[model samples]
Structure formats: structure tokens, C-alpha cells
Target: MTSREQPSRKRPRSEDASLKNSLSDSERETHEDLIFIRPMRPLSVEPDRDDKFWYKDGNVVLVAGNVAFRVYRGLLASQSTVLDDLCSADPAWHVDGCPVVHMSDRAEEVRSLLSVLINGKTYITKREVSFEDLAIWIRLAHKYRIADLLENSLRRPSLQSPHHSITAVNLARLTETSSILPLALYDCCQLPVETLLNGHTYPGGRVEKLSADDVQRCIQALSVLGVQRTLAIVKSMDLSACGYSCRFECADHVSAIKTELLEDLKSPGCRHPLCSWARFMGQYNRDMTSNVKNSAHPMCPRCIKTVIQSHGQVLLECWKNLPELLGIEVEGWATAQDA
Candidate 1:
């Protein structure tokens, strides 16, 4: 049967009773005849002897979907309270002389969970778990109340990378990992709106989807970031500290820089003969400190010092309000100075 037409095993009894009550006499007869005439086959079960996860001496067999994993019962029970309760509640559900625990999770998800639990590992090593594996692991960990697994999954380096920021946001929301949300949201702010809405595929062949809410947050944050970037650029263009010889030239240079920045904002791409404002905003968006001394613009030494100090102050203000800009509450974020 097609997935859409497949019967739901977990459908509520109230819905089933309501449907039965609504059926006409002829419809009821036809439904009963259909049920009586259809042949039901015994469930086809088999052991998955994949070398990656299967253990010959394991005590319990975990069946997730069509795949079976032979793993230690004690390890799983000790690590997961839900598993412990299940084993304690039913001591007699056995298949082929070994206890069989049927799980609703997919085979790969179960394998990822077991990789962390039974293998004497605190976290799945970066080499072992891909972005997709980490996402699934966090979900299963939260479902099964595996605290260590959930924590480790959140702490994985993959979640902190720029490429996986959207995935991190989705996983953070799913697992309620509040600490990672602010950083993930900040990273989302750096991405383009189209990339945020349509999702980006990582180099490892994992496609990450951002929710509509996440996309909206990015949109709002990007708008705020643009305003902040413009304000910072305009504030740094103050030429009062310029020397008498270069004051007028510096003022005109700053005006040209502002115009270039505004044009770049409209196009949202790097251009040849990159403007000072564009470079500064690029560093600013990445939350990096501005290096006025190395800026491409020609400014008097005194004016450069003034620009540096003003940009520093503006960056501090932006950092202070970053959480508010992203519509998230962040705790213990380092200031620009601290960074």
C-alpha cells in the first residue's frame, strides 16, 4: 500500500469508534467483508549482521524497523532509564532464545545511539558521526532520556560550524539545547535569506532544512544587522580628529565609502575595488574586531585612531544587543573585548 493510504497502527480508539458510528449499514457490511477476506501474513523478521554494529556474543537483539542489532542489554539499560523500565516491565518477550526489543526508530538512528552507549564512548568521535548522524542521535537521545548522549551530541564540533548552523538551530530547537541557540542564530544571521529558506547541502552530502520560524528569525536578524552595520559605518566616518592637511580629503573618502557600502548592501555580494566599509561590515558580520590600522582606505593617522576607537565602541554596543537582535536569550556571551 502507498504510504498515504497505509493504516495507522497508533490511531486513537475514539477516532476509530467515531468512524464506525458514522458508517452506513452497507458500508459497515462491506468493511467487515474486506477485513474478513484480506489475508494477513506473519511478520517477516531477520537479524542484521552488519559488521559495524552487530556483536556475536551480545545478549539482546534490538529491532528497529526491518534491521536487527545484537547488543548488550545491560549497557543500554544502565545508560537509558526508558530502556531500563522496558526491560524491567517485560522479562519474557523473547525471539529465537534472545530478548527482542522493538523500537519505532529507524535502523541508522538506533545504530548511532548504540555507537555511543555500548562502545564505551562519551561522545561519538567527529570522524565517526556525520552531520545527519549527529542530528538523529540528539533526537533519539532526547526521546530515550539519555542525558550524556544528548549533551555530547550538542557539544559536537559539527554543530558549531558555519555550514551546519541551520541544522544546529533545528536540532537545538528539537532537543531544547538553549545554550547553542544563540550561537546558531548568530550564524544564521550571517547567511543569505535564500540559503536560509531553501536550505544548504553540506560537503558531506547532508541537506539541512531550516524551519519557517528559523527563516523568519534570520530575516529579522539580518534586517537588524544591516541597520547596525550602517550605523557603525556612519559613526566611524567622523572626521573631527583628522589633521588640517587631510581633513577635507578624508571626509570625501568617508562619503565615497558609505555610498559603496550602501550599493553593496543592495546587491549583497563582494565587488572588485572593495570599499573600506564593505570590508569592515564583512568582519563585523562575522563578529570579528575591526582592524582600522590595516584598512584599505587612505586616512590620516589621527583619523585612523579615531575610527578604530569609534568602531570598537560601536562593536561593544552591537554585541550587547545581539541576543535581542536575533530574538533569542543568550547567557554568558563574550563581549568584543573579551573575544
Candidate 2:
């Protein structure tokens, strides 16, 4: 066979010299850029009598540059000052006046200013955010890319108190808006059902008038949004005080939720530790010889089929009476109104 053209002496290894040289140059440039840029962002500068920047809309500092913003500690304590600043129609030397300027080149400076504004405040001061003020500040921050400041401000602990009624309008305004804080998710999950059902209505119906379809939608929405913990919290709510109001308005949801829960229980690895004791105390027995959660003998499929073909009331009655017949100790299930 004609010898395949003797593989030309394998080209000697290139040693990645070109790649190594290019990478070294790139890394050097990046390091130089960071070193040069970081210091341009000053943490603090004395405000001149004719300061170029001014506080507008709470903590935001508006300067004459590309959508630049900063936070100021002293201005946050006064609402009137914030309002007056935002109302300034012709704020010279302010970002609002020169909104078209491109400040993307000075990102480091903006970060430094924001760090100064937010970090300067004490934890107690930050926690005192009202809904309206927070709404305004978050809007400005998002517009200017104040990611760190937004995180710090909204991460402050909040309690489930009636302090939200005053800010209802603001909360409603920001719904589904990207201008909202990431922590707003926490607030949404924490909001009282009473507050939600109230739905911008005051001095009237508290529990939302949920129809069958509305209940299905809310359940699906909550599931899709991955708020399982919140759903569990909702599941645990005690609605006994409202009596018929709760029964009529919330029954379908409650029943559907329980049905889903029972299916979940039937799945593998769904054993709820806290409810295990309660579950064990309610197991059905065939020969009436089982003690509790565990049954001594399994029943025929015909018995199961007959039970499945019954109404909710009949099923509940059978459940309640199962423990009695089989000598299991089960606390009778309470009604939706009692939940």
C-alpha cells in the first residue's frame, strides 16, 4: 500500500502562547479598570451650600447625570421635604433635569453614593419605613439600578400589624410592577387574609367573597408562584369566629384543599412528622382488632369502592365513626366553619 503521506512531523505543540498572551493582557486591563474606577466613587463628600445634588422622593439623591441616584440619611426623617423636592419642576444640576444623560460609565460612583446613603442609617431608622415612602424610594432605586440599597432597605424586619392600611393605595399601585422590592414577596405572603379579602374596601366586608372558581384560581396561583409555605400557613388559619360567614365563603376552597392534602398524604415520602401521631390515631381496622393508626387486616376493594361513592357528609360521618367501630382513638374532624 502506498504509505499514506507520512504524517508530516506532527506540528510541534504551539504551547498556547498566543492564548496565554491574550488572556494576560485581558486580565491586566480588567484589574487596572477596577483599581482606577473604584476610587472615583466617593463614600462621602461635604455638601456645598449650593449642592449640585438634592434629595428627592425620600432617600434618593438626584444629581445632573445619567439617571444617577443616591440615598441621604437626614432627608428620610421628613416627609414634607421629600414631597417638596419631588415637586421641584426645574431642578437644575439634578438627574431629573438631565434624564437623557448617559451615566452608565460612572456605575462605581453611583454605588459609592448609595452605600453612603443606606449604610449611614441605623438599623432602627431603616425599619421605620412607611408603605408610601418605601414605594417611592423603591421606584427611584429600580430606575437607577440601586441593587444593594434596595436589598438593604427592604430586608428590614416587618411585623403583621395594621400599619398597612395607610399604605394600601401604594401597595395596590405597585402590584405586578417591576419597581417593587424583592422583599415585597415576603409582605404578600405575610399579609393577613382579612387584609387581602378587604381588597381596598374599608369599613365593610372583610373576608373576600370567594366563589368556587375564584378559590381554584387562588390555589393555582399560589402553587404556580411556589408559595407552599404560605399555603400551609393559610391552611392552618382558624376561621371559627366568623361562623356562617366563613362556612359559606370558604367551604369550597377548604374542601378542595383537603382533598388535595389527602392525595398528597397517599404519595410516598409525604409523612408529616407533626401530624403523624394524629394520623396514626385514626387508622381503620377490618377485624376490629387493631389498636390505632395501623390496621391489623386490609378490607376488600368492594368496601373501598362503596365508601368512595358517597357524599362528603356521609364520608365525614364514616370517618368519624371508623375509630369507634375499630376501637381507634381519633379526634373528630372539625367543620370548615370551625377551622
Candidate 3:
């Protein structure tokens, strides 16, 4: 019952192994050329290896610290314009490095290019960047439509630098109409005068927050509130009588901030006509009247209206201007008019 042993068949080899041996000598040489080529890994703290990481998914390549050649090598060889642009030094002498290379998270240009590479778009940025190069980056980011970057820039705590005082002053001047945050803007009245002067180029620019002697400073600073409407806020707070009458110079300077100082007239029930007179003088300009074309005069009718509408003290205080209305001699008028 012993049958002839069946001839054993050769087992199939793995495709990888068979394919390896299938090449002729020269073909085998070419097979070695088929070595797996991965993309160069993004530079990091990790050690480098010959086996590169391929980026077939097409990501925004973030190449940092002298890796331009590697990044360029991976893509199809061209005239090398993109690589050259990245490698060249910044044309603006203001920037310290090639903003395109060694992409620091701090570099605005690199941040921008990185955003475009990864997110397929740009951003607007102008944060508290102190460095000239970073500032350029912020400007470019702003130009390129990177909104998040711009917001991030704005949200950054303002830098404290030797030139920050000057920068803050200039920023305030520039933002007088732009609605950007005011430089030394909030409670600048409380900052030290020496600090403000040493930091900024503002010759006569006084920081109000630090010095208490600056009533005019407060008025001037408050006048620049274009970004924030302060009328209602000012009206809500109780204002003390400014004792300019005691100081001859202070009384004379009253005309300088007549418009802003007029808010004092919004008192609850103080009807001294002199106060109303001063208030009327504050806003009663012929130019304003001409612009609005109200038939009733701003001073005569409005002043009386304010008197009638207010509580008893405010009414009496408003009517106190009555003697002045008829050109009668009021003793204080002699001094104030003389002033």
C-alpha cells in the first residue's frame, strides 16, 4: 500500500523577494535606484535620518533654520526663483534677517508665509511687535488679509521699550482718527511725566494719569475721544466747579477748552445763570448755528429751554443769565469780561 511519494511542489516566493531577484545585473542596479524616497522631515529637535518623510498630501511646508535647499530639492527643479526669493536678505535695511528663511514664530513675514502654506490663505496682523523685522511682518500680514494675525497683533500687550514712549505718543496721534487703541490712551493721565517724555518724542505731551496738576491735560486728552463717544459718560458723572476764577491765568485759558469744559453745565439742579451763560458761550458758535439751520438761536431759546426743563436750582441758575441778557451790570461780568 505504499504509493510513490508525490513530488513536492516549490512554494511560491513573496512578490517582494521574487521581484528583487527578477532583475538582470543591470536591471538589479536600476532596482537599487528605486529606493523609497520620503520627503525630508520638517526640521525639529529630533535627529536627522536618510529615510526622508514624503509629503504626498501637499501640506504647507514649514522649513526653518537653513532648510531652503532641502525644501527646494523636494519639488521639481525649476529656475529656483522661489528658493532664491526665500534665501535672499531683506531689502529693507529695517529688517535684521532674511524674513523668509529660518522662520521664527516671531517673524511676521514667516508667520504670514507659513499661514499661506498651511492654511491656504493669509492673515492681517499688527500686534505689539517691537522689532523692526517683526513690524514689517505685521505690516505684510495686514496687507495679505490675515485677520486673525491682525487681531492677535492688536491684542498683544504693548511692548515696553525705550522708544515705546515715543511710539505710544505717535500711535496716539496717528490713531486720533483711526479708532486704534489710544497710546497712553486710558488713564494716560496717571502715567509719570518723566516716563512719558523719556520714552516718546512728545515735547509738550504730558501724561495725565501720573500728574494731578494737569486739568488742561485732561481736557485735551478727553477731546481726542473720537473712537469712543464720551458725551453720555461725562454727563453721567458729577463734575466739581473748576476754580478758574481764583487764578487769573486759568480763567483766561478757559476759552481754550470751552467745548469740552461745557459738560459742567449738565448739573442736576444748579440754576445760576452765570453757569448757563458760560455753557452757552461754550457751544454757541455762529458756525454751528449756520450748519444746522435751526430757526431758534442755540443760546437764547435753548438756554431758556434748559432752565425750564431742569429742577428748581438748575432753573434758577439758568435764569441768572437774565441780567446779562438785558445788558445789565453784573459784578462778576466785570472780572470775567476783563479776563
Top of the candidates by TM-score:
1
lDDT of 3: 0.33
TM-score-better candidate, 1 vs 3: 1
Instruction: Quote the lDDT for 331 in model 2.
Output: 46
Instruction: For candidate 2, write residues 66-141 as lDDT tens digits.
Output: 3344444233223222222232222223333332111332333444444334445453254565443454444434
Candidate 1, position 34, lDDT: 24
Worst 10 residues of 1 by lDDT: 1-10
Q: lDDT per residue, candidate 1, 113-167, as tens digits?
A: 7776765444476365677777887877776667877777777766345667887
Q: After superposition, how far is residue 318 of candidate 3 from its true place, in Å?
A: 22
Inter-residue clash pairs, candidate 2: 63-95, 239-339, 280-293
**Prediction 1 TM-score vs. true:** 0.63
lDDT of all predictions, in order shown?
Answer: 0.62, 0.34, 0.33
In model 2, which runs have C-alpha deviations exceeding 4 angstroms?
Answer: 1-119, 123-136, 162-198, 201-339
